[model samples]
Target: MNTFTETTNTASTWGLYEQMRPQEIEAIQEKTPIAYLPWGAIEYHGNHNPTGLDSIKAFNLCKDLAEKNGGLVFPVVNLAANLIKSYPGVNFPKHSIEFSENLIRLVCEEYLEQLVAQGFKIVVLLSGHAGEPHLTILKTVAEEFNNKYPDKRFWALAEFDILPNDLLVANHSAIGETSLQLFYAPETVDLETLPKDRLITLELDAVSGDDPRLATIALGEQIVTSFVKNGSIIIEELKQKYL
Candidate 1:
């Protein structure tokens, strides 16, 4: 028997696309026609962290942002690219599922088209999967589509794109990312698997930042709070400028 475990408790369906009703969606659209689309992939993040970390983190952030900023979380095709194999930085042939750039572009465009059709005035595409080429494709697609639709606007960025470098440095599966999961999805992280004495380097296990032992739920909450604070501000700015 497969028993389901509930992760979050505060109005579980507050901004989720899957759990919302048509009328509720329309009501939100009547007020703020903003949509948050979280994207990520099934990539290996050492044995300690779940491969779904990127996707889960992005989804969790979207949920929080929607609650604070007011938006309907939209679902995207589960496809990701720019794995360790192609990326210039840390490369780990870990358990990862990759898709072609062409497919990623096509899928992204399809979702944007649907969101535009739904009459969302502002569309925010945040990718937890942060890589230069992959992120560029999303941003390019959004920008070109913006030109196509004068009335509607599309903004695309990685989770780390809008964050300050000092507060939350971007690493593959290092301290920052791991800490995020710890805060958002504690069950998925097992720091004990990683050694506490030695440094956890990219060469060792594709962990590109500080040691995992240093990560704490408090630290994760701090980073998450920063993301939410900054994210909410930027989203409010978008609403004021455009809406």
Candidate 2:
């Protein structure tokens, strides 16, 4: 029933760090000293969506933005500070590396330092995970980093904040996220996997928002378009001010 035109080749000229050549990297830095880092967490989204939903959505959005606006899309950091344990079906896998709030802060600080060192004057930190604590930690780190290095500008915020109030209805694995996944990475979602009968479980009732069954690819496209438009506006404003 979804009558949306999907681009066969979604790739773009966004110089993703790992895939970019030296000349391409130099070109972006020379043209616009702006960089973006999409942050997300590896956690449960529901039975329908993939566990890496947060990172996947964030990275894809950043890639699209960078391709249009001219910047470098750093590799997505899929590790988040903490997992919301209250939700059912959530898994906190043990990491060989330390995954703590302090570590997150340190990692962000060092990454920004390196970006500045590489001649990037402005850095955007966009997170797909909406955990209040996680967002707060990132905000605190960005503020501290800016204070220490006033020459470089850093802004950290959740991706949903870029959307208009009407299109900003977001939840953990509900319609918003589910629709995003359906649009951005359709292979990662299988609506048929969700339980048919509505049970009053934490995963279904408490964590998830309105019925994900109502999610549509059209809605996903609208959300993505809104994010790109608003994000581009913010990026242009920063460029005008910083560059």
Candidate 3:
């Protein structure tokens, strides 16, 4: 595909005007004022994966979509919700995770409000972290935001929703997330440092749900391709319906 880099709000060349700083943005805004925002947390992924796995995944996805469509990626927001604390054997939360969910929801709500105030008519919330409460709160906030600000028309969409199960759940590293990173950001990975012991494998499965050692760049590319196609389709449909 042809990749063209346009100046975005986050880019040094463009200021707060964001997708509208350039003449193209003004023209497109009148036609399709769409923006994609990624939300993820800063917590442990596994011994093999980096702690910024969620943020990295989210940022890369936004970058891909933004490259195709005209939009800007907000800086990553790292707030742990479900994966609050860790134990020796388990990389996930060890205690009850209730308080953090509310905190995360409020923070997200504020950010969403700011985005709307800044003139983003169509916003998408793409999250990599599967923390149930954090995700749940995000959904609630999206609903409330749309209801309160009908003109803005904001929506929260999961990356997996735009991908097929074969792409989302068939590979290593929680199925698709690991593969995507492998394809897009290989330097973030270290296969030599990966644990190979049988005991370690079983222990990791008990906590993180999938085996990270099995992740590959090829699998990640498949997932990324599927996401780009489906995500663009959804964005186009929303644009036709709303914008």
Candidate 1 segments exceeding 4 Å error: 1-14, 85-91
Give one digit per residue, the lDDT tens place, for model 3 in 51-117: 6777778777776776665556666667757663533455455322334777888888888888776
Clashing pairs in 2: none
Model 2 misplaced stretches (Cα beyond 4 Å) = 1-13, 86-98, 199-201, 204-206
Q: What tens-digit string does per-residue lDDT give for candidate 2 at 47-158?
A: 7878788888888888777876777889888767656553237443332122577878878878878887888888888888877567788888899888987777898988
Models, CA RMSD each = 4.4, 4.2, 5.3
> What lDDT does model 1 reach?
0.78
- Alpha-carbon shift of residue 61 in model 1 (angstroms): 0.6
What TM-score does prediction 2 earn? Answer: 0.86
TM-score: the better of candidates 1 and 3: 1
Enumerate residue pairs that collide in model 1.
none
- Report the C-alpha lDDT of model 1 over 193-229, residue by residue, as the tens digit: 9877777777667786777777877777777777777
Q: Rank the candidates by TM-score, best first.
A: 1, 2, 3
lDDT of 3 at 221: 72
Better of 2 and 3 by lDDT: 2
